[model samples]
Target: MAEDAHGGAEDANVRGTPPGGRGSHISRDHAAGPGARGADDPKRMEGGVLVSIGALLLGMLLAALDQTIVSTALPTIVSDLGGLDHLSWVVTAYLLASTAATPLWGKLGDQYGRKKLFQVAVVIFLIGSALCGMAQDMPQLIAFRAVQGLGGGGLIVLSMAIVGDLVPPRERGRYQGLFGAVFGATSVLGPLLGGLFTEHLSWRWVFYINLPVGIVALAVIAGVLHIPVRSTRHTIDYLGTFLIAAVATCLVLVASLGGNTWAWGSPRIIGLAVLGAVLTVAFVAVERRAAEPVLPLKLFGIRTFTLAAVISFVVGFAMFGAMTYLPTFLQVVQGVSPTMSGVHMLPMVAGLLVSSTVSGQIVSRTGRWKVFPIAGTAVTALGLLLLHRLGVDSSTGEMSAYFLVFGLGLGLVMQVLVLIVQNAVSYEDLGVATSGATFFRSIGASFGVAVFGSVFAGRLSDRLTDVLRGQELPPGLGADALKSDPKIISELPAALRPPVVEAYATSITDVFLYAAPVALVGFVLAWFLREDRLRGSVTAPDATQTLASNPVERSSYDEVCRALSVLGTREGRRQIYEKITARAGYDLLPAASWLLLRIRRHGWAEPTALSEHSGVPLRVVIEAARQVEERGLALREGHDLVLTEKGCGVAEELAGAREESLAELLGDWWGPDRPTDLVRLVAELNSELCGSDAEQPYEESVPRPAGRVRPGR
Candidate 1:
């Protein structure tokens, strides 16, 4: 069973119970969005969402940092561990474990609950990090890195799934944009920090650093992150998961081992290839029959989902392939220290930050997201081709420019694809869809690195052999020694250095030149993506079963449903109210009612904030404030709006009036038996309606109980 997006929980104001009184007792009817939190959920109304997001970003930082931070330190690790043959395994192990675990985490989160699962993931990640730091050999490190990847996979997927739980779809872009920025920031920070640790301290510090941050993130999530959950028995698809994992592992192993550890036509490589293909076919068959498939085959039927998943794969391929090798080229060929190489990568990070932040804001404002992916992938292809132009003597400025273009293209594509997939699915499928897309991207990264590693190694080997063929070798060293490590070339005879460095530079460029077409495929795929209309809210109509369970209420509740649906989301809900008022021959106070409820639920922040969040025009909100003041319903004490005793009575009357009017409209269908849980329905109704699920404005608002907290207090 798919868990509720917001998890399990009832509300304090769920019944007509006043503050400090017992909440209405009721059975679970429908899952409420995070915005639907009652007065009972501690801190929901008082900057809790922002606080929770802050903690999530820290978790995201840890995951992203680990992926790239180890890049610059890899050479040093190889030198220390003396396992040049197992170098790729260090990265491959993590990617393989992470790829296999991604879908399972999402499925388990749905079956159980996200909060506990996410917390467990954090603990596991921290434990793995400590183990990695303690590892004394290559095999130990690889095994520990696999452990880290297991937890890392959950960190990436669950953090995104959690956002779906808290924010509605309409408001998701803004937060997604922020998350993009966080990813970008960590990308830059990771390399720089890794370089610093490897250069000034021990490379082991790279893993140890996760301890403090992970602890803080865990504490924050455990204490501040409240997800009410109800568990039901689930048919876990172990067979399907195993088949998919097998397919991914086999394919990645082929890419990593073929042409490197063994000949391309070797029996081991050929058998693995055939096995992977057969497993893929079997996996598809398994998914078609599984009660709850790990990766739902139905998702493939969605055109946008399929297209976005492919594009995500291509982007990941190009991105990881380029990022993994660029620092090596800079540090070895350019003769820069690890720290300087990380600093030099700043141009790319800057481009990414600017493009991602700007594009996200544009998407939020305009909702025209399709153009970005098309244009971004095209630019990414161009950037890769430009990188192919670099030679051994290329200037730092030239390299930075190429990297900048690449980063811009990457930034534009990455976040939007996730948004596209999320927007395309229902809330129940949010976790699955999210992890599926991530799984494909991760699989792509694994293969891209493996394939490109093969290409780079082959090209570099051929060039090195060509250059060193007739030359006299040193007494103890041979050509194969240079193939194992780049640092060996730096330590070679001065006369032999230029040719080897030039060969490496040429090979790196060759890798990019060949990889360009992969991004081009993404550009082409972007054109086929259908632009589904972006929703104004994230409410999944089917997720809540309240109306569906009540046949009469379900049939007659259309107008009420329509009214409640737009309660706090859109500006056009006013028209729905106008129609409601017309039928009852009563004036409807849409603005006043919304404002009063806003004040009641979250207390006061600012008039302008309410306008922005509620989607009402600022002038309309200001005028509504005036009308409420004139009616003695509210008074502006300084910047804060307070409801007096008389105002509270009027507010109650307005609330009662709206409910009575709605009930009367359905009176015939409802008959004399009013729903016993009208309060829960209203709360759920308004919860679905409220814009509280929307992203908070840039200027943080700390709301307190209106008029309850004295100025001195």
Candidate 2:
């Protein structure tokens, strides 16, 4: 819904496949982190990995920036292209194409490998951008945008998924935090950048700008990126995907053109309505029987998933509708330059960032999420009502205040919607539920833009007609010309300009007034969402995951891995080691158990290196090594500690214990009938945790126990 760039992280690897093609059962040898796939792996090389990450970030930026940047340029585009009635189509087409293509891209990447798919996606996006820049008409631009959306959707999904492939679970949060920061920055910078390009350069520059960035990303990715490809058989739900897309298209068409483009009762609108109904029924039938349904029909039976989906749709409807038209109101009626219009929208972006961050932190801490959505929707409705008060003479300050209120309301709801759906569904449903929630939001955005456009176009036409009933216009100047381009008002007689400006202002404001009821619907629905105890993974999501604007498109395993990674990071070395040691029920100190597991994972652990890397004191590392050896768990070979046969057994037991402990946090998700993929995830995560130096146990500056002898002594 936010045109979030990192949608594909969850689907980075094929779901249900054992990580690295290891056996289905947990193995002691697999205890090494998946990051250790190959010594020559480019993703593991410190410098090369940075370069690769930079390329991925650039790819994500190309996609994300396009989503927000185009909004500010829409007014200029329509004016130049002379088709105000088709304005919304430009945005709707992109959203529709991207939303429909997202899952397919992710699945294709899993099948054919992401690196090649990623490059292909980049090329497609660049081609679309080039075509869009060269377009001469509204229809051409709209069609080109859909082409762009197809590639843009893949860029977002694959870039995020590739992160999972490139980074181990332990260090993933740090990098993902970077991705989240990018999303946040784009939210503020996108419109501003669009405004600058439109005013200083040309509207065409907005599309052209992506060319240089995307080409660089493509080159860098091709040269430096290398990830293993594991192909697995998949049954893609082609029919379900097509039907859903068709249904959404039909509904959006009805909303956009029903009253304005065609009479509401006209045959075209009636035909589309009936077609949409038929498509909906067909989609359900296809989904119920499809091997891998796009939107699993069973999820609707879950109350939380259903309610969250609806609320998400409403949020998307309200948020995108306001975003699409606010620029037009500022530039056309308020008489602000395109660049200044972007500047004036900052309050709303700031409000959204602040509230979303705060609400996420609060929910993570308190585990009560229902209140935010309820309050958010209520405030959103209020903000819409406040926006309705804007007139031709509304001050910049008044507009900023109203925008901030509206943004604050949106932020509170957006972050929690995914979390709600994830917490509600079973392990098998986690991935689809997350994607489905965002999918609804995306469809809502398409509807909102279309509906808002219809209202604005119809009202503007009627208002201009009423006000100019008896006015004498310059030769060739008419209401139609004024409707096509707001700039045409400047050519009108000085007396007529006032009525034209007022008409533009009221028509746009009335749209907000009409949309308030939509937000109110979300408010009422929020009251019905049942508050469940938060899963540990959902409790403390990485800052990037929490603050990111896009829907987190990940499989169940990746989602759990990410959550566990965050939890492991937040717990730090000492706490996690203590818990795992206790769960292991071994007759050894936590430090000694950690040493054995570490040695077993890597074959050997140098005491000094261990202390330096893990922040465990040199004395403690030596003492732990000595203890393991005294217990015959490990043996000293030169300066490194190597696991003995008994040590290997103990280490495997410790790893198993760690896996069980991690699985316990999932609650019902780890039931007896848990999916094998989840079992694989738990095992893989345990191995990574044990092998990662970043996760090695650390003790604060504390003296060793009195009974423990110095290693030399």
lDDT winner among the candidates? 2
State how far residue 343 of model 1 sits from its true place (Å).
Answer: 1.6
Model 1 ranges with Cα > 4 A deviation: 1-58, 82-86, 109-116, 158-181, 215-229, 423-431, 538-713
Q: What's model 1's TM-score?
A: 0.73
For all candidates in order, the CA lDDT equals 0.66, 0.81
Q: Which portions of model 2 show Cα errors greater than 4 Å?
A: 1-44, 539-552, 585-593, 613-638, 642-653, 699-713
lDDT of 1 by residue, 1-713 (tens): 01111312332342253222111222112112336545544344336777888888888778778887887787677667756546666776777776677667766786799888889889889999999999999989989999998898788667766765665333344455465566656777878998899889998999999999999999999999876574646788889978987897898788777887789999999999999999999999999999888888989988889998898788778877777778778877888877777888888777766776567556645657899999899999999999899877889889899989998998787657765776686544554675566667777777787777788877877888998988887753456777665677756778989998898899888999999999999999999998876544322222011100000001112212332333333434554343333343434255554565445433342577556544556776775577567666577767656665655554454445545544443323334554444434444543323313231111213221122211221
The backbone clash count of each candidate, in order, is: 4, 2
Worst 10-residue stretch by lDDT in candidate 1?
543-552
Error of 2 at 485 (Å): 1.6
